[model samples]
Target: MIWQPLLLSLKLGVIVTAVMLVITLPLAALFTRVRRRWLALVESFATLPMVLPPTVVGFYLLIAFAPTSPWGAWLERTIGLRLAFSFPGIVLASCIASLPFMLQSLKSGMQGLDSRLWEASYSLGKGRVETLLRVILPNMRPALFSGMILTFAHTLGEFGVVLMVGGSIPGQTKTISVALFERVEALDFAVAHRYALVMVVISYTAVLALNLLQRVQLERRS
Candidate 1:
């Protein structure tokens, strides 16, 4: 029972981190190049997840996934996919809740990049995509790792949004955090302690590794 929820949380974290990397990379690069006015709006929108309460985001997502809504109706009619109280729904909610962490990290990395490197890549006849791949990405390894770690960690501990969007369906939407809550509600203190300890250790280790990596990266650069 404990292993099931732990595995589910791990799976969700991996999927969410992978998806976030794909979506945030190019978006962060775009933000780095855009003018200040547009960049401000984009940053605000991207960072809204961090600013807004998780329940608020979950509430709007619930509305969007309600059967009466156009999106929900269309999804059900066309693909037979339901977002409310589903595994995929929780994944989507986790992605949104954790978006700002990945985006902000990558964006900060991009912004901190030396402009001369971009100029040099262009002068060497590399196109934008080529330069981004060969020059920018290689230099942003620290940020990439940091973003992935934070996103994965955040998703693993997600509770409010997951509860609102996925409920506590065992083996489907019941991740470790949900399981922990359930265990506590059932007054299973021993099991809840185990789950909480595991989460705390995992989260702490990931952050510690990220910090050490960043320090090494800085030392290498200097």
Candidate 2:
């Protein structure tokens, strides 16, 4: 029983983390290279989820994902897929909600790299893509790990956006957070405790690992 939601949360985390990585890599790289007023506006929009209330974000996402909405309707009609109250819906929601954490980490990593490295790569006749894959990414292991783990951790605890979009469907969208809420609502403190404890342990471990990684990076730099 408890294992179900736990496993679901893990699945959700993995999928969302993977998807976010694919989505953010180029965006982060772009943000790292570009300097313009419009880019700041785009960055702000990307980072908005961190500041906005979860419910507020969820509410708007819900509207957008609703079948009645043009975006949702076109998706369903064209792709034969539905977003509202579905696993894919929550995945989308989680990706949007966790975008900034991964993007900022990778962007910071890119920005921190020696600009001379890029110049050297260009002098060596390497394209931007080759440089990113070979030179930039290899040097940013800490940031890569931080982005992946933080995004995974954040997805595990996601409730409002996921709940609003995916609802509490068992064996599908019913993540540990949603399970915890249900257990509490049912006056089942024991099960709720288990769920909550699992989340705390996982989230704390992720954060601790990130801190330790940063410390190690600092030590190596010093």
RMSD of each: 1.2, 1.0
Worst 10 residues of 2 by lDDT: 28-37
| lDDT by candidate, in order shown | 0.92, 0.93
TM-score of 1: 0.96
Give the lDDT of residue 86 in candidate 1: 93
Q: List the residue pairs that clash in candidate 2.
A: none
lDDT of 2 by residue, 1-222 (tens): 789999999999999999998889889989988878799999999999999988889999999999999999999999978998988999999999999999999999988889899899999999998998899899989999999999999999989998999999998889999999999999999999999999999989998999999999999999
Indicate the TM-score of model 2: 0.97
| Candidate 2: residue 138 Cα off by (Å) | 0.6
Residues 56-95, candidate 1, lDDT per residue (tens digit)?
8888988898778999999989999999999999998899
